[model samples]
Target: MAHIRSRKHAAAPQPAHTALALAALTMPMTLLAQQAAPAAAGAEATLPEVKARAAAETPYKADAVASPKFTQPLVDTPQTITVIKKEILQQQAATSLTEALRNTPGITMQLGENGNTTTGDSIFMRGFDTTNSIFVDGIRDLGNISRDVFNIEQVEVVKGPSGSDNGRGASSGYVNLVSKTAAREAFGNASIALGDASRVRATVDLNRPLDIALPGSAVRLNVMAQDFGVPGRDEVKAKRWGFAPSLAIGLGTPTRTYLNYLYIDQKNRPDGGVSTFGLPAYNFGANTPGAAVDPKNYYGSRSDFDDVTLHMFTARIEHDFGRGTVLRNTTRLGHTEQDFVLTGVNAVTATAADPASWTVARSRQARHQTNEILTNQTNLNTEFATGGVSHSLSTGFELIHERQNQVNAQTLTNTTLPASLQQAVANLYRPNIDDAFLMPPFKGAYAKGSTLSAAVYAFDTLKLSDAWLLNAGLRWEKFHTETNGATFTAATATLPESLVQNAPLSLTDNLLSWKLGAVFKPTADGSVYVTVSNAYQPPGGANHALSTSATNQASPSLEPQEGSNLEVGTKWDLLGGRLAATAAVYRSENRNELVSDGATPASFSQVGRRRIDGVELALVGQLTPAFNLSAGLAYMDPKIVRGVPGATGNQGGAIVYSPKVTFSSWATYKLAFGMTLGGGVRYVDPVVRNSNLNNATSANLPGTESYTVADAMLAYEVTKNVNLQLNVYNLFDRQYVAAVNNGGSRYVPGQPRNVLLTANVAF
Candidate 1:
């Protein structure tokens, strides 16, 4: 059989709404002349309020979200949300978004499929795939790549159906990353760090006011560079660098304009993972399994590599219309390019009696892909009163164009060589990195697709009384997607080889989603609320590519999947509003799944259903004047009520990769002499890789076992402008499996004990 190859294009056409979007942005500038007098007067009133709030803010707590759609403060919001401030990330020395997410519960990582290794942050949340539900500054950030936090100020996680907040997305929830921008202050900060595994990193953040040319104007810049290698895994290394710049004008005035840009470049050696032939329940020709293989074994060739380049540009305008009303408009252009070639262990050949003679089959995989997005959004927020009822209303309109192009490759072995070498086989016990292997050449096959969407949404929060409040939101969206691709097939007996170039396929869908909530405030610092929300996932929603297979869920002929959630929660502020506590119980369900319909010709229908019932608890903010804490616990029960019979891991049992119980907590205390000590513990229950009617593991072997890990941090403030910090990860050096492939053929081992020390300077 021949492989299907693909390639990507570097450029794409601008969206049709570009002109209109630009008009919306420039229209506000015309009001600058008329509002000059009022703007100056308004500036005087806003500056003092901002200064006072900044002086009273806490390091680890946020009172409200950056988005204007959420009209109420955190205490009054009905949804389940967690905000991880930059201070927490700094103290922990977290470099990637994956490490920062450890502060939350009920999230798991995923290894790739049977033949390939997953790269980047492949996140699973609340029993659903949330890899594509990440956003930056209220706009979707689409790609499969690791994200650095050097330019990030905070991370906000919202759990539950949120179609009203954004557009179509996963059933679980979404994450929003807040970027650091210009501020009306002069400050500079820098850090340099060194760690085990030849790790080195440096970062800098600087902000300054430019009042000489434009009053109230400011500029900010952030830069990062890193080079590191995996401690236990040999020949695996990553090198990356990035920079972000932001400019703001009229910050304190009634009209504000902002410009921002970001650029990143990465080069890395990917890991393919170790074979699972000797592990428990790994049967080889009816032979009993043996001891596990060395976790440090590097099975891939040294030629494998992954590289990425990213660029983004944004412009925003905000104009105060006076009387508690504001108008805002934003435009963004983002592009990402990635190319990778990796070697994975596919199967084990244990025919030899000696374990040293055993070998594992290797498979080559490569992809050249590019993702591009252009979006424009306009919003209006106002406060009004009618019939003695006060209302806070938020309305917005959005236009988006997202596209993805991927070029695949076919691998051909050098059959002239020896059998073992030509077959791409590596010794199971002792694999060599300098092995003879052939690099795959790119063919002409590729896949290209794009999605265009137009949407309008509105949200209203009504104060029925001092003790009662009602919140409602609704969104209507229309989307169109087009796909074009080609595939190849090798020649067979009595048949000639062929290359099939498919005609353009298109899908159009209209979606309506909403949410409703009611809150009851029994006291000044506490509230109870109940909310119901729904979201939709249409064909080509997560990715732009559409499939032609009848059984595939991304078939354009299929109906969109529907998800709903019902949650009841309560929140309280304690110790004179220094601490926040929250608890919630929720049930979420997804319907319209594509499944085989037991028919003679094998028909399919959209009658499948699945559900998850969970309980969550959280605490954040200062426990006392000298202590701070952030912690969360989650208990999830996932089940499939209907599905295809005998489907791997889908037999009326718990969903694959979904843990039952997860807990995470971190706390720090300030001591005398400007010293601080912090530590955290994380726990995850066992998960089943395969399921039958009895919900048993596959082949009667146990699934991934549960594990507990701990981390510690110590910091000393030598002076007001200088500090030193150290972080220790996996202090106990516990050996465990971090992730396993769906077929149970391979696994990635957890990181061993490692430490890093840094010197931080601020002025």
Candidate 2:
């Protein structure tokens, strides 16, 4: 068993706590006494031996997911799922959700569109966009702002088509972030860290059982504050603070209720990325090489800023009945508002004869946006027997309303600016930070959209025999969406025009998703399974936005896109159930993609198809009493199955931002006398982002090259209540491009070597 750390309650002491602390302090003597006593001749084994089993549980592995919809444990679950527990986050000093996600493979980051930067977590997984598929405790969380992990319990990533698990979503799957809640336990913990580039962060988690009329009631509060600078970059800053408070009633009784509230505020300076003039695989035409720009250059204006405010309220109740039956209901209201003014770079304007006169054209981008959601869900879990078979079943129904409102800004992209606005053209080698430019005007253009959905789903796992099991799930949903917007219009000589109002657009759709799987267990600790699943993505399903253009994918008249996945996998529990190993081979496809119709008017059709075949291997949990490890590797082959004939964009071409291989691993080992050593490595294969199908194989195309990054950590326990840790990122300081825009004109460079020291305290 792994070593256990004593937990001291901040509230009134209990008998169990005292006994556990005493037993830990005198383990050697207690073990000898147990050997001498021999359980008192089978007189109902007393509590003396309970402390042995009370040792702290391993944090590297989890047996079951927190969601009640999963009817089986991770070892028996017939899907590709990865869970990232909070302990791992603490050891790595990861403060953001995106940073923590580096533990998994086959996931890549992305820069924004042409001449812009994508806000929040712009993630690409399994060759598909997953930005809209993020959830918080089973409820869709929509926004373009970044997320903090201070109040999170664990992050669960469900791979493959999981439409049966949630409503309409990405074909690649979704990410669910579980929150921390109050329990019938009392403890207090806090941490403070300081890192390079003027980084500082602190957080506190406190939980205590109430001594009020409700015997099992408890309360928990988690708070965080941070101010940091982006490594290897100048004039960039991130500042944020947030808190989560939870209350629970009847925690240990037949009836339970929980209430939680969250609030966060942020003020940050967004990065516009450095110019990509001098990078590898880049040229100045006719096979002429270009000079690389400084990676640490800050091309954005000092006044550019992004501010956000968020609020969320949730309530849940559960009831348990005899004979293994339970019911639960959850409701949530969430809202987020963001306001940002950013600067972006386009292609460079070079003067070959005079390199010092080269300049890069700049543009302005801004948005005032808000996202809101209201949802309620009810679920039931029951276990029963029918003749010779046993069944574990889960059924649920959900009602959701989601909305997004955005105010557009008119960017000043004209190159014929007066000398007073010369800041729009920045010097390629030596830029002036004090240069000034006027903010673009807004002509009162705005867009507002909403989606309303009702869904019912059921999942069941039937145990046919000791070595055989069958799992099936089905979901049916009905949805309606509406989008309304207005834009400024220019007047002609014959008529006068002003703001033009577009008619309200509406769409309605009914969707059905299902999955089936069979498992065969050859031994008590191993299982082999094969599964097939399906998902659907209707028009305006992700963002609740519709378009009138016939060629647009979000047009209300278009049909829904369809996705399917097939997999054969195996799972094993070794090292006395302390370690888990899994391997899977999967084939996933998405059809009904929008493509050129090849007609006179140049319309579009939904006949395009894309496919990806991949193999994944993973290992997680404790390798020995003093060692812990988590690792994963993925190999992918993505192709365009059907597309517009001879089109350079998709015809028999590779998808953008999709890599062929990726790997990530992290491990930690305890040394003698309260010391630990840890390290990790991450690798991403080269990715092509160019639209020209024929140029996909060319070296000069706009894309990111393969890169590897390494990190290390060391920790030492100061006393029973305090410990110190230090983490070093980019151990080798390798220079590489982390992400590139589709236009390939700009790129976000990898971070340089940096260090952080943290102190943790518990009482």
Candidate 3:
């Protein structure tokens, strides 16, 4: 672990007027105490009065306390925002980004290839994939790659359509990762962790004064490294190491600037696992555990891969002109490159009885991506008595550009013998197998695409006679995209003769998206809000045409997918804001729906429309002073209202992957002597694969079962600067699948029960 140390500078205490305003809002009880003071011998009581005044004037304060004024109030935001504080992450001994997010409601994670570096980890929110909308410190880091969680301050999940503030692509919601920043006081901490699967990790955070000889300049550094050993289930192994360093320069009076950089390198080797389509749907009946093969031999010898590198950088400047007027400018850049190779079992010979005789086909894929973003946000807000009405305004501008490049290749060996015979000979003479067989390389394909977006939005809140407050907002956006790609089959000897050809394709789209909303606050602690928002997505390379479409050509001249959502929600704070709860009902309609048939991978078309109606309830904050609780429940019914010819049933049921019921809850208790203990449980109902049209044979396909998982953690403070923690994940050791591929043979299972121990020291 690295060590961080920084000099301390104490700013002058706030002026008397500002202090009075804060006291009026936060400690009205102080005024009551003053009013209740007994009228007595004033001359003799003068000394006590003076002492009380002096106590209020004391400037000394705890260095680690969080100021209420600096923290944003949850009630002020219209959307549902959940925050996972740094203290919680440490107490939970969160070893990965996914684990940290699992504690949040309405979020689910799917591990890639036994949690290997080469596999792409995916997150889903509200039934929509979230790979393209992740953010770091309010900047978009949109790429199909894994993100490292180090030097993180907190994770905020903003629910519902956030286009008004976050620009486009936020149809479901957005995740914001706040990075650690230089503290104004001296502080440093280091921690080491060891866990199951031979996992070892070390992390350090340090804040140091840049100019101890001068004043007002500081630098902060954070670094993390982890090595995950091979899992007991297979021969897979993964390792990742990364660092984040930042520098802050305090310009003379009211201006500050900062620069930060991130570098991460990860590598892994994955043994061949079961394919989704190669296995039976039901694993509980008539199937012996590990019956297909010895659990030890499940990993084939030819499977291997690696993820090269990922890099990111960001810089920003903030200026305060005075009196609630501020301006902020920021820029961010990121790049990723990956190369991987895997041995796949030929589908033609993938039979249960002859599974051992299945031949292996080698393949490789390489991908590169880059993203750049620029934003200028200005807020001119003021509160004053104007005709007995007070108003507050917020507005901003944002621009973003993202691009991606991908190349893929595959090859097969023609041994001119039965797969069983080939496997036997290859095992006996491994070295001579390559020489005796004819290798035909599969021609590679490339894809290039880009997205450019710009938006300007504004929202205002007007206090109507104190009791009723009115809120309104509007956003306008322009989005454009272009993509071109080609596939070549020249590398294979049988391709040209068998009608295989190289073809090039291109696509482009430009459109506008907008949103509007209003809220009525009847009381300080309760409010009702309604919103109408429109979102759009331009068809890109990934959703482009393939050879299997009915016409043998891509859908001609695709249009932008558009949606409008109407929502009504209520928020309330109970027990002096210690307990918060929200309930919302929404109806969203989508046009130009992207629909695909299971008959062929490329059989995709745009349907007329679809609609989804749902309700959500969530609660957070403290149930009592000693017990903290968080929970969420959701119900959704999504269905297609229109259908095209040859398409399946449209209005019978909800869409695929949209489970009707989901619930999560967590509770923690504070104990004596700086110790805390907690536990949580999560449950999700089974989801159908093809909800619109279900066949009995396919109905038996594995739906995510309704299962419960439990986690617990214990933390003890050894000293002012030292603490220790122990965490147990999946306490019940339940075996369940997280996701299944189309073929039903490949199932991604949830992690087994695991334990981690951590020690931390701070100064």
Candidate 4:
């Protein structure tokens, strides 16, 4: 069938109420500014008293790690960035990367076809699924696979399209996992944890300066390993094991080098049985027996997968030329190879009555990826007097190259009904038990898909007089992509045919992206800013598909997706910078929008425009002298302006898997005798199923109901060098589906309540 696609153009204008709302949000900042004057004066008047208070409070040093050099205060950043620290992950006893992300607002997950082990990790951010943009440390770790969290120091989520800095990725956002690094001081820490799911984990981090006898350098290493046996209902079980090791060396005074490697292997059974027949819309019920089948005997088979191994090497050098000028260069290279085998019954065509006629399929896949990147950044970053005004300039150039190869082979077998189902059916026909059907090898490969991007960017932050801070930046990027591979169709009676083709396709494009903003900081702890930015993504190999036209049309040429965002926000600190809050309202419009049609399998056409408007509120800081809290609430309204002609009228609503509202909060309080207690709650709004459809004939699946989850943890200090912690996830034992397929054939249920105990020793 020929695909139908159309394009639309619309100019999104901000509403008056939106401006008013933004204005109101700034009142707190203004109020805080007005209050700071008197407090500073009072401190000066009572210098002795202030000094005495500072001395007394200095005894209780905070455990929070200082932000890295590249990181600025949250309020000072031009864009939204959420940082999840190592302490938070340890305190919560997070098992997987997904569990850790759940605490962050405006993020969601969609399950893969297989179970958690082999079923790749699919994540959504800001209403879009672009998991390929995920990064390890500072380099890209593209592909569809479960990411390991061991030896990770923190995770940073940079909201909004990061194409300028992250190359081609999700137009919505990107996630960066920062690996643990050696410390300058001598220190060592180790932890062991046991959880209710039969989960066991151990990690150790140590850093020691090189002996004085060694030549001008320091070396350190970190290592971690974990094994988990997950317990599930109905005879389902999942297991995983992994390890990571890293080494770092500092050369001279201004140069550093690091090397790291990771290896993970996992084997597990499917979480639940796949449905044999399609179910009705809005069926949130449990799995049950279908016609001609016994639910008791139907289950999925075990699968084994491994991330195999990954190697990364990096070098950084910094040079300071006096006179407030510095130049820094960073280079990185990474390589990864993965292999796995997945086994499962074809749910699309299976029944208990004809159990003997059931068909089982097994697939083996391998992937190899490599990346080389270099960045040179120079900063004058100094204030200078010009025309009685202060000016600051920063510039940088980055070049990146990434290439990957993916291969897969599948085999299927069909057999007659088993003795257990002989009475249920009179006649059953099965495919021949030939060698071809037993383990027929159907192989396909995607080879030499590579991307190269080069960017030169500069920005200036000018103190235009004392009342206003004006910032503007522009980035010019050139991107090229090439892919050479073959496409294969699914098997029918036997192994489907592979269309052998190797037509190398390449595309080059140059685009300019820019950001402009103005911030007015009336006082040290208050500021209001308004910004406008433009971002774009070049078409890539993923968009390639087969065409029936003669001469084998190969991959079609598509226009790039472009977006513009407008935002206004205000930030404030109350109670002497101890409590902070921020509120923002933004609207984004996209051109040459990409939309998925459920009818066409795996075909994505760039057509129809869309827009999204949302409001976000965040608060982080101490609620009282002995208590701390962090919370976020977000509301989004997204709509489609145009869809396939004659299909749906301005089909606009919540994007698939994108909830309308989300809320998350956490609080921690100090207890007696060097102890602390903490807990958090999270809520996701109901999703509107089939909300993108235009006609009544299309299935209008009801949206999933909203759900709330709670988690708590308790910790006590055993000694200066030892500590113990206990954490409980899903405190209420809430049972709900985490994700559902469009046809409702495969559903992923949320994990059950789990408890973990951990002990840590530091020296």
RMSD of each: 7.7, 8.7, 10.8, 13.0
Question: Model 2: per-residue lDDT, tens digit, 1-763?
Answer: 2212211111111000011112233344334433432332233232233253432357788766777777887778889889898999999999988988899898988888885587788888888888888988878898887899998888888899889998788878889888888878899999999999999999999999999997479989999999999889988889999998888876655456677888899999998888888787775553235588888888878788999999888877665542446667777778899998888877677756677888878887788999998777878888888999988888999999999998877775546356566868888877766778667666556889999999999999899999999999999999999999998765689877677888889999899999999999998778999999989999988778899888889999999998889999999988888899999999999999999755566667899898989999999999999999999999999888877656545677777788999999889999999999999999999998864576544333368889999999999999989999999999999998888887777888899999999999998
Candidate 2 deviates by what RMSD? 8.7
What's the lDDT of the predicted structure labeled candidate 4? 0.55
Error of 1 at 750 (Å): 1.2
lDDT of 1 at 587: 93
Q: Flag regions of model 2 displaced more than 4 Å.
A: 1-56, 286-289, 415-420, 490-497, 597-601, 696-701
**lDDT of model 4 at residue 690?**
51
Query: Model 2 compared with the native: what TM-score?
Result: 0.91
By lDDT, the best candidate is 2
Residue range 1-763, candidate 4, lDDT tens digits: 1111111111111000011212233344334433543443343344332111211221111112121212224554456556665667777877567877875688877644332223556787777665777876545676555666766777777666655554455656678777665444678888899886567788777767666653234444555566665533343443555555444343332223333444455544344333323233433233233332222222333332343455555443333232233344445555555555433333333444454554423222333333333332222233355897665655677777777666655333233223343221211123221112122244644455676778787776677755677777778878777777776654568777556676677777887887787888877667788878776755662322222222222333666677667888887766666666778888766667555553444345677566668888877767677787778898878666654433453355546667879998777788889899999999998654354364223332244567898989899998989999998878998855566554334455556687889998998
Q: What are the per-model numbers of colliding residue pairs? A: 5, 2, 12, 7
Candidate 3 lDDT, 1-763, residue by residue in tens: 1111111111211100011112223233323322332321122234332211111211111111111111124454455556665666776776556666765656655433221212554665665555555767666665545566676777777665555555555356667677776644667899998888788889889888776643356777788888775433454566788877776655333444556677778776643334333234443223222223222223233335556576666665444333343344455566677665543322222334443443323222323334434333333333344787765555666676666665555333334334643432221101121223323243455566565667666666666654555566566766555556666644356555232333444454444555555566678777777767666554552223322233322333566556667888888776665677788888766677556544544365676566667788877767666777777787877676764324354444445555677787677787999897888887877655544454224422444566788888887889988888888878998766565543333344566788888889897
> Lowest-scoring 10 consecutive residues by lDDT in candidate 4?
9-18
- Give model 4's TM-score versus the native structure: 0.77
**Tens-place lDDT digits, model 1, residues 259-294:** 788889989888888887766555454544567788
Write the candidate numbers in order of decreasing lDDT.
2, 1, 4, 3
Count of clashing pairs, candidate 2:
2
Q: For every model shown, what is its TM-score relative to the native structure?
A: 0.92, 0.91, 0.77, 0.77
* Model 2 poorest 10 in a row by lDDT: 9-18
What TM-score number comes out for model 1? 0.92
